[model samples]
Target: MAARTQATRLPATDLVRMGAIEKLTTRQDFETWSFLVTSMLGQFDLEDLIDSTIPRPAEDHPHHDRWSRLSKKVRCWLTLQIDSSIVRELRDESSTGWSIAYADETYEVIRRIIVGHAHTKAKSTWKSAIFMKREDYGSVEQYVTAFRQHVKAANLLKTPISPFCASLLLLEQLEKELPGWTGSIEAGFRSDIAETMTENEFHEICCAAIDEGNNDNADRSKPTSDKPRSSDPNGNTSSNLSSSSNGQTHIQKHRMAPPKGKSARQYVAEWRAHEPQRTPEGNYNYNIVR
Candidate 1:
């Protein structure tokens, strides 16, 4: 007679017993939980598998039941993956209470824990996006692009920054670079511009202001007359000498200096300081006015 063949069964490996939970430590808790639930649904009931796989204490131990063992093992796994503070809070709360006997209840508790963590992380991201400021010397276009990226990463579309608020923030930084242009923009912001503008419109406005400022600076640096003036026949070596001298004298008397690399607010303050005295009724005195 031929020898009878015996069937051999292989014991489950550690990888099989742990399932995907072992690899989940590197992922966010919300993603891990989602992947775990989706991948394991057809194989076995998650709660039942967890209860059976986790080791129970000796019979003498007070909390030696399957539920207690499962809870302990779950906590241990979570501690390895998440922050110790979150684990400790979960432990104190006993999120999956002793009364939780069904798989649905276990899943609900776990879902809540993961969702809570996700919410906290999202909130921190939102705060960072809201407080974001433009880098020194950065362009308005660059700043807006960076802001959009941050808002998307933080999942802040539900509470996006208003165009007016974004414009105001951009103006704050632009004021330092384009004081005169920003002063005019500020006046518009206080009027109907704030309500009707979009982020793109604001960006365009900033770009225009920058261009205008550059042109103004270029014009100011150039000589008033490129061609040499013919020599004055009547002992007038310089043209408009009288007007120039009078203007210089007036500037000296009032201590008025041309604005150079100063913010609008600073320049305005200086100009106001040199102005004639005002009456008690807040009106300028014609006698003292320039």
Candidate 2:
């Protein structure tokens, strides 16, 4: 019989856009990411590095060197796809959070973020990733960096996204927010870039919303006395701990004043025709930072 021929092996760089996939930011995006990653690994026959079937060998074994090299490459590929915010938190858990011996370390930091008291802070980090944007940081590079720090801290703690925070839901908000924007003016962001607004412009949007809310309150002529005060016979009135003097909700106040541009009323109006995102339906203790 003639000698059997073997096919040549493929390197990672040959996968073309294998690295072009979006960074895994939220658990919402995770399902999609997982699908893509698994597909990519399988295509190149590299799934053994992470999949359950291939048990890791010890250092003394002959296959250990080759396994370690490929495993490390897989780990690099995995980490590179994660946001920086999540990476930082994972670093604390282990430099090789994605252990060459196994894959649990890889997801360990996606499990961190935010450092809000260690675990709580981990969540804060993830929130930052979900709400980060390209425009807010003045540059795409800066924005990506900030996004990663937040992602690193809040691993395994994906939360539901508010409708307002979804970039697609709020796309064209910036362009429509022109003092005289019409017929797609020169200064407005293109629709292609709007999808990223949720990650970046959400802070500014919240400020505009807050201003609008306050404006509505002003029109109603509602007294700032949103809560009752305790008075002593000595003629001193004590403020309630439940609310702020300016009536900030029991949750921490994160008021970010609108930037120098269109009126807050304008931004709010173009978005939802003057109806803003209302919240706090129950005992879910979540605080979104401005």
lDDT of every model, 2 decimals: 0.49, 0.49
Q: What is the C-alpha RMSD of each candidate to the true structure, in Å?
A: 20.3, 24.2
Tens digit of per-residue lDDT, candidate 1, span 1-290: 42211101111222224343433222245555545654553252233433323433445554335434444444444345445554555465465463234333443344445443356677776676677776732555565556555554454323456667666765676676567777887776646765777757755765675576567657769977653322322433332223454455222122233445777687667667875655455544331111
TM-score of each: 0.30, 0.31
145, model 1: CA deviation in Å? 4.2
What tens-digit string does per-residue lDDT give for candidate 2 at 1-290? 42211111323443334454688776557657766877877776665555543445555665555555665667777778877866665676576443433343453344333222354555566566666654676433344345444443343344435323343322333333322322233245556544444534554543443454345446569655555543433445544345668877564433434345857676555654633443233222222223
Give the Cα error of residue 277 in candidate 1, in Å: 38
How much lDDT does candidate 1 score? 0.49
| TM-score of candidate 1 relative to the true fold | 0.30
Candidate 2: residue 211 lDDT (0-100): 53
Candidate 2, overall lDDT? 0.49
Q: Which one is best on TM-score?
A: 2
After superposition on all CA atoms, how large is the RMSD of candidate 2? 24.2
